[model samples]
Target chain A: MEISYRDMITVLHGMGFGVLFMLAFSGAIGVIYATAVVGPHWPRSKWDNAMFRFYLISMAALAWLATISGAYIIYPWYRAVPPAGTADLSTYPRALLLSNPHTAGWHDVGMEWKEHIAWFTPIAMTMVAYVFIKYGPRLALHRQMRNAVLGFTAVAFFSTAVAGLFGAFLNKYAPVRGGPDIVLMREN
Target chain B: MSVEQQPTGSGAAAILAAGMGSLALGVFAFAGDAVPALGRAFTFWQPTGALSGVTITAIAVWLISWFVLSRRWASRDVRLGPVNAAAFAMLAAALLLTFPPVMDALQGK
Candidate 1:
């Protein structure tokens, strides 16, 4: 098996960081809901509080990593302009999609939307993490604040879902597929 | 801080600032797409095109607003009802404004 360096980085950005961040949402929402909605009835300890803080902080970090890597690392490669009269546009995912009528919408709609919308995830999640950490279990006492936090978290999830869906579809249609090859295994 | 003693202002600041940050991103993105000059202006990084500038500016807006609002409201208990309503409205606007179709419609494209 072999994979190009670019492909590897794309996988890490999409699966390693993006999907992992999305998965973290389930745990985050559940815990936050339990803490805020269930209130004092839920069992609590200093350890639990500390662990939740770490969890939220980690999620925020993952969100930042995903968007940063996507924007700075992989995106440059994906959107690189092909030199004049370049026959093969495969290396440029954006151009490759735009060159074809059928796939044009994938770039116009999918990439255009994904590029901007994905950002909201990090911004929203960072606030959620900070607010939760700042208030801790005391968040349960402030009903409106709790509702706002939950609403923001939900929006973060929605933003992530939109970005992730488009990212997956874009890769499937026009993959970012170049760079030095790294051989994983040599078949005899 | 104890439940009774904790101030909601800090949390409110964060929430409102996130909403504002999101709104800034949407506005910047819409302007960048609609106006060619604005698009070129937002190309702070050549490789990433306008995206680099758009996100950086939005983040700066978010952080600065958060800092200013937090400093002002940290100690006091601010009303959250209006704040939540405003924040959620901005969040919704951000979602719509980032969408290409919605952007296209607004631009009469």
Candidate 2:
């Protein structure tokens, strides 16, 4: 069973947008935590606290889901296709799918780094969630604790940004040159 | 330090969970790159090392650290603050382990 290039493109594009959304939410947690409170003063109100909680949990979930989904789809596809140099000519289509043919710049290097580090984003995000959920209202009253949570969220935001950037870079450079760009085997 | 809510058993659990999550990610990446490579090496099958060797190494680094660090403070309750160091280490080690593969891709070797 194979897919058309159009469908492949669509899947990649959809994954990209999903990751962007994940980044936005992850960043939102850090931004909100910073200016909103420094402890002592506590949350502005119950409403504000509720909203903050919502964003924190959402960021955690979104980042993990996006990270897992992207890893699931992209890495496996690369694995399935043997490199043209390593495999026979009959396996050209697999090798020609995502990776670039020539090493002009940081294209491949940047992506490999991105894929590896991106794994930890979910773990970091989980810490963000753990700190927020277990501590609860106390986080608003204690300045030091608040800062710790802030640091975690900030880290989360940074990692997600890195992942998103590398993912886009890889996508832009995918498709081997001087080879069949799309090998359609009927779209299902 | 003055806070009443300091040091609890739960912190270690949370930190451990994070470490495990990192381990899972690393292992998955390794498996992704390894399976293919293994098949190609052994049989006519063009196995492309489904698991990434880099990721496996990263996981080993993480697991060892988790064991060593937990032992370092096994008697005392793990605080979130101190555990941050472990988290950071795990994150850094993961990225560092994967550097070679990325370089290979960039060099097109």
DockQ of each: 0.71, 0.25
- TM-scores for all predictions: 0.97, 0.60
Give the C-alpha miss distance for residue A147 in model 2, angstroms.
4.4
Give the docking tier of candidate 1.
Answer: medium
lDDT of 1: 0.91
- Stretches > 4 Å off in candidate 2: A1-36, A82-94, A97-101, A104-108, A140-148, A175-188, B1-8, B19-81, B101-109
> Poorest 10 consecutive residues of model 2 chain A by lDDT?
A89-98
- In candidate 1, list every pair of residues with a backbone clash: none
Q: Write the per-residue lDDT of candidate 1 for residues B26-104, one digit (tens) a residue.
A: 9999999999999999999999999998999999999999999999999999999999999999989998999999999
Backbone clashes, each candidate: 0, 22
Scored against the true structure, residue A102 in model 1 reaches a CA lDDT of 99
Q: What fraction of the true interface contacts does model 1 reproduce?
A: 0.82
Q: What are the per-residue Cα lDDT tens digits for candidate 1 across A18-134?
A: 999988999988988897667843427778888989999999999999999999999999899999999999898999999999999998999999999999999999999999888
Identify the candidate with maximal DockQ.
Answer: 1
Q: Name the lDDT value of residue A165 in candidate 2.
A: 68
